[model samples]
Target chain A: MSSVCLSMEGGSAASTPAALPYYVAFSQLLGLTLVAMTGAWLGLYRGGIAWESDLQFNAHPLCMVIGLVFLQGDALLVYRVFRNEAKRTTKVLHGLLHVFALVIALVGLVAVFDYHRKKGYADLYSLHSWCGILVFGLYFVQWLVGFSFFLFPGAPFSLRSRYRPQHIFFGATIFLLSVGTALLGLKEALLFNLGDKYSAFEPEGVLANVLGLLLACFGGAVLYILTRADWKRPSQAEEQALSMDFKTLTEGDSPGSQ
Target chain B: MSSVCLSMEGGSAASTPAALPYYVAFSQLLGLTLVAMTGAWLGLYRGGIAWESDLQFNAHPLCMVIGLVFLQGDALLVYRVFRNEAKRTTKVLHGLLHVFALVIALVGLVAVFDYHRKKGYADLYSLHSWCGILVFGLYFVQWLVGFSFFLFPGAPFSLRSRYRPQHIFFGATIFLLSVGTALLGLKEALLFNLGDKYSAFEPEGVLANVLGLLLACFGGAVLYILTRADWKRPSQAEEQALSMDFKTLTEGDSPGSQ
Candidate 1:
């Protein structure tokens, strides 16, 4: 996978321009705003933030929008954004962002579970709950594997090479699943509030639905940026910089060194 | 985009195998089965296939599932499945399949509109309707662009090359949006039938929810197959064969040709 990244980096040097980074930054800003707006709609307009009541349910959307949609997108872009930096530093930042996303997501889950328990609502009964739990579980496992294999002491080169593709593939799959789950959860909330007679012409219903559309758009944009071959980080000079860092780190770890 | 495909094909020669095709086939089978099952649950069990009154509403899910889920997926896979075949042939098949999908989706839309008219329900008043209409509209434009640029006399090579990546990106994006719309529609259907008091413990509700989950799984699997870089078709020999065909066709098209 690193080879793929490196090759893309090499391929991008002549084709990409300084303007791309600005476009990416703009996309990030737009995506984050949409996510935050969705959360605000749910939390503020819909009475989701009140304590010790059904309002506690609002925390779920707020945290998830922040963690899964916004932070997760930023994490995916870290390598591209910091292309000139040392590879190790980018990787570490990527891992840390994922960790933060996980923490926030967990809190989101707790908010929903607490709401359910307090209201005596049956937990894990809807398709949304099932998907939410499954995505979270898989995310946790993915994080552990990623951290152990790609960070810290790390795996041997051969093993890392083999696992890298799978890691990226799963990472992308998890992100889409998160977005899908959020849409499902949004649908559930809207249906619950508006009942079967819900109409898009209604202000609140329209807001919720538009929010869902925005989430889908955000996911699509993030995926496009991450997956486009031409948008890959440039590699020519970065290779030299990364190798120098690697050599220094190795020399420091050598037994006879000091 | 063709260059990217060609390069991956060259890279995949050593890595991909005959067995990889089997996996793709299996994914197709599983995805189609899940889509069909979801339709069955709606059409057969939920009175979707009934001829009169609200029962006619059943046509919506059935047609949408067949068109958006099954045919749309097949259209996306045409280039990969027919990699060894001429590019022109694959492009035609891809365009035709999308046309068929659009026609069926239009029928599905009509069914819902007719049902609304008969039942005195407002048309295009739900998020599901909004999403469904938007996806269908974009799909139509995408098909037109793809057909004009890639098939028929076709655009100039430079233009085709430029549009290719956007075509693929939008195609995948539209497909994902279709799945998202379907899930939302399914949620609406379930909530209406099961009422706001729905508990996941109910057998029918569970079935509906599981069907939605199955749809998500199918979408995820199809996307994985489509996006994985290593799974790209081999290009070296195919390029030679395509160029030969192009030469013969161009020669045949010359004005002085007997």
Candidate 2:
């Protein structure tokens, strides 16, 4: 086996695998699928909003069906990738990502179903369009990151690889941004749907103000995550080993090459 | 090496360990964390208008500090566990989670430092008091989940093991209810904080309406994650195996034992 494969199989290496990062990236994308399902649910529950009428879709029923479908697919994928695995650390990581995917899909299902049942408003889409954008954007970002990995042979940031670190750094940046956007979008969608009932419950509007502040904070968190983490540049020797073909390169060529 | 260790060494076990369920449980908690953080950020920006003022605190500053500390600790743990090794799978998982932690921390930092830079808002907590509630509630939720893990060795679907999943189920339900109540409280907060800005932005009450809908979705998402992602209770035999010490318990006692 190649050293990279050996490292992965032996559990003696320091880095996580490519499949794992893609797994996380994909997990984040599940949030988008939730938005889609939620939107569909809201439409159906409200008996199909006037605005969405022209879209040739029934909201509530479609939401339930599609949401369930997405949930199953996402959950199954996560299970296939993470469950019943061994190798303490790796299993833990993959398992966590799997859970995240399942959670997001579940949330999306609820959001859509509840909206459909409550029919709380006329146009769920007008105000909540941002949520859809967030979900779609997140998935797109993950796809890009996952697709990028196929271009490279081994993991990033290894003594034998230079691009690995950069890939990680950029990939993370994309994920955080996507998350922030999703949160913002979700808030906007909710507010648009139920602002009137909210006023009657609280004469002062304290809740709206507080939620707005929270959105700002979440946005800040996204920014913080972006700036603090970076791909560490490789040392000179490490860089060279990463450049040469493994077949032609001597093991001694790089002193720190593990 | 112990046979138990060997069985789990390559991380190839077909059955999930107790830790697996907790990891899955953590995912649900983390989803709530995301929602809470999002709400907290919005509250800090708009003030604690979305929910109860009693829940308010300096969400931005406190979050920044706590988030950073956690990120640091998490990163160190990851590095210690995975760094300098040469495992593809390990490396990928480590890198992704590390990035996730860092990105979230960074977003918090940005919100904190940028408080003074914003145009409309004069002070940090000027947004609303209810936002404090969101931060408070979210942190409390996070603490509750983490402590539950400490209290219960098994999570998600465990019938026994100190902390019953029922208690967790109730706690999560209560948290979701609190979010709904907070949403109903946000109307006045949005009216006062947004004022003319609210009017200027919309088709007569569009902004508030949108905010309401988004809050509804947020609440909906919370409910979904708590209820849906929870693992189903294992079969009697499976549960028995799960409860027993894998190493000490002989397979002869249970016909179905793996």
Candidate 3:
């Protein structure tokens, strides 16, 4: 996925000024990662977070790394938006969504680690799952908005001039995978009644299941809306842009030609 | 949803040549319902498939009605495509999918009705569930392919556009609902597995549950690919045609203007 995003960036270099800010967005993501890791460590080690052997607390390192990678990619996108010499308002706003995704990921991961180690399935686990759900939620939106732009460029408000639907798909797949992963984990926590191991956490687990399903449905609807919104626009600007790109599209036989 | 589709059709009429066929598609769907209903009655009566009770069979007429409505809508879409003066090949192809959906729904209704009457899991019941699964699978694809086109009239082709990330979610929801509905019927067939009034069908029910999940995932993936294909070419073609719509786009702030 990262490779696809990079290649897309590479391809867009000579297209238009709109592509520049995405580079900065990627850089901003890197910086956010560093900040998040430091924050997580401080919260875990120094902030009186109790440790438990049963808990995969050490997974924090891996989570931090993953979080940072995503952040780095996102920050660069942000940089491309605001700091870059040639950038569009749409790209800038879209790039900042990466920051939203980072925050959600950070909080969700920490909550999961903390709640899991605590061996509790009440408020804490609920919080953890909710955070994870939100993370996936935000990431899904990011894909619908920004990534769609990248895949279908000639459309009104897409990301860039490239026709890499694969990148957008990967981003969406990751978001779904992330949601599924969290659901599986939550299912485990529910069946085990992790927070309430002594008794049946059936109620809680069921609640979580329902919530997860609801979240997925709501998120899916939002995505559909976003897709519609992305397409529904019939902008003169986009028409002008398409006209400009028609020569390249004809020569390229690319999917973005339309 | 019909109203939504109509509004969407109205949104695209001036700018797109492909919009006309959906009206035809809807007409085809309406015709299919009569055929489907005939098939359902024939499958039920000629095959000695009487309902266990009139109340049970009569209860969900509303579901049938709802199904018919969608079928009708789909038929109109098909007709519009075929009858429209400015027809695109893709539009006609899309209309054909309605037939697939119509067949599945009819087969499924028969299976459900017979199982309810026999009060046991039957070969027909299993087929129905599988058939329903197939229909849902197609819906996933249709939405994935047609969704963005409806939503973003002039957007580019992204994986997200072709494949709804939320489809996994709504797909899962619909699957679970279908499973639950099946189980409720199966439980009747099994006599709650309390005393094995119908021990013979237990294994079949269990297998259906397992197979349903697997197929839902696999079928969804395959259908998604179909959506991707449908979206790719048109998005590119639309990109090429975008310049021609510039003046209209500017005049009407069609959703794409955003």
Candidate 4:
């Protein structure tokens, strides 16, 4: 088995398996499946999708799951999954996926707001809404900084090095916040329907709860794969094959090399 | 300024500050304050505390915040805070803190269950309860495994080394689950009283929402400090002062020494 060297802070390699591609791929498939299942739960059981009214509320969960959970996760995994590929290509894919997630999440927010306005319900009223809005706002800022610093017209090598840790920190934080918000949203939706045949123990309620649990599980797995020191992307000699047009590339080199 | 060598896995030291005592202490104080504030909001603003009936419900949040949010966080930080201290002592403190957290959490669970039983309300009837119970169950298992494998009469060195990563991963996962559960419980409590003077926009409702936000922030900060590589405990030269009763002690030695 080929071993990958994990580079911590641009130096000091720790050997782990380079064969994590399959694991990353598997997590992606499982995470996407769970997101799809949650959407189906809403579309089939709760109410069919529609542009306005209660049906519009369904779009909120569906879009948020697809965008925040699936797409954003894929964005984070781009580096690990494409470890052998050119660094520039993986960086492009990461930025692009985040953009897509942002657009979809915005649509999700609009859907919920429209529904609330039609129903004469107050906006930003619940903890779920508050968290959802906060995550979205932070995601936007993260995207902006990432794009400007790492993607195009990148920052100075010193600046990029300083920001790298913060970038990873906030990225993981926002993802966790999204997952937490989704769970709270699901609870609110389920509780609103509770009573009569649709109590918390009923099949529909159970399915919703299971969806929330799955979201948490998916999130936990994704984070484990992302944050584990053993699972970090290996810095190979081939990484230098990519043109060093961006000054920030120097940040990854050992200080002795300078 | 003293620099602590961050030993990843068993070897390869990277120097970072040994001066993180302030950061750790500050986070602990701030985290506990947030937990206390959340509980106080429930007790003082919503309704005063009582031993039986609806008033007894106040004990649930108060105890849960103290146990799951504050105490559990402290348990996770023991290793980092006592990095220079004896490993055995830190491990014992870690386990003991978990035990205290578990006891307080059990009391919190009983408080809610008693209230429900007295009011003839259905049990395990909300997403919050389901998640809360699941977290508690997993926590029990985590504690058992940690105590048996890492503390007294600990497992073989090989086993302990293998289990270290899993222990850290699960510890973080359970803590996040607790925070998520707390947020869901807050939402449920607030919504149940939303139609009356406790409307979402009301002062009490706003305080409740802020408490949920604070819990999220506190969890994020705790996880950041715990997970950051640079913030890991330094393997001091004096670590060898302890008896080599456990074979795992050799793991931290440089590979050349081995």
Best by TM-score: 1
**A1-258: candidate 3 lDDT, tens digit per residue:** 011111122222333344234433443444444445434533543243333443344344334334523442343333223332333444445455555656646654675557554865333222223334554565656556554564334443243534335444445444434434333343333333333331343444334444334323332332333233222222334444445556545565465524
**How many pairs of residues collide in model 4?**
0
Evaluated on CA atoms against the true complex, candidate 1 attains a DockQ of: 0.38
List the candidate 1 regions with Cα displacement exceeding 4 Å: A1-16, A237-258, B1-16, B241-258
Off by over 4 Å in 4: A1-22, A195-200, A237-258, B1-19, B196-200, B237-258
Task: Please write out the lDDT profile of model 2 over residues A1-258, one tens digit for every residue.
Answer: 011111112232233334445544554455344444445444543345332333322332233223323332333233233322332333235334434543554454445545554554333333233344444455445544544442223323343234443444333333332333333333443444445444344422333344344333333322232221111111222334334434223443433333
Clashing pairs in 4: none
* Backbone clash pairs in model 1 (N, Cα, C under 3 Å; residues 3+ apart or in different chains), count: 2
Q: In model 1, which residue pairs have backbone atoms overlapping below 3 Å? A: B9-B235, B48-B58
Question: At residue A227, what lDDT does model 3 achieve?
Answer: 35
| Candidate closer to the true structure by lDDT (higher is better), 2 or 4 | 4
C-alpha displacement of B180 in model 3, angstroms? Answer: 14
* Per-residue error (Å), model 4, residue B105: 0.5
* Runs off by more than 4 Å, candidate 3: A1-87, A99-160, A194-201, A229-234, A237-258, B1-224, B229-258
Candidate 1 residue-wise lDDT, A1-258, digit = tens? 112433433334534555567768776877877877876787666865765777888888888888887788778888777776667788889999998999999988899889888888889878888888998999899999998776745245556668877888788888888888888888888878787447636777778878877888778878888877766656564576546545654765532212
Q: Which ten residues in a row have the lowest lDDT in candidate 3 chain B?
A: B1-10
Best by DockQ: 1
State the TM-score, rounded to 2 decimals, of chain A in model 3: 0.40
The DockQ-derived docking category for candidate 4 is acceptable
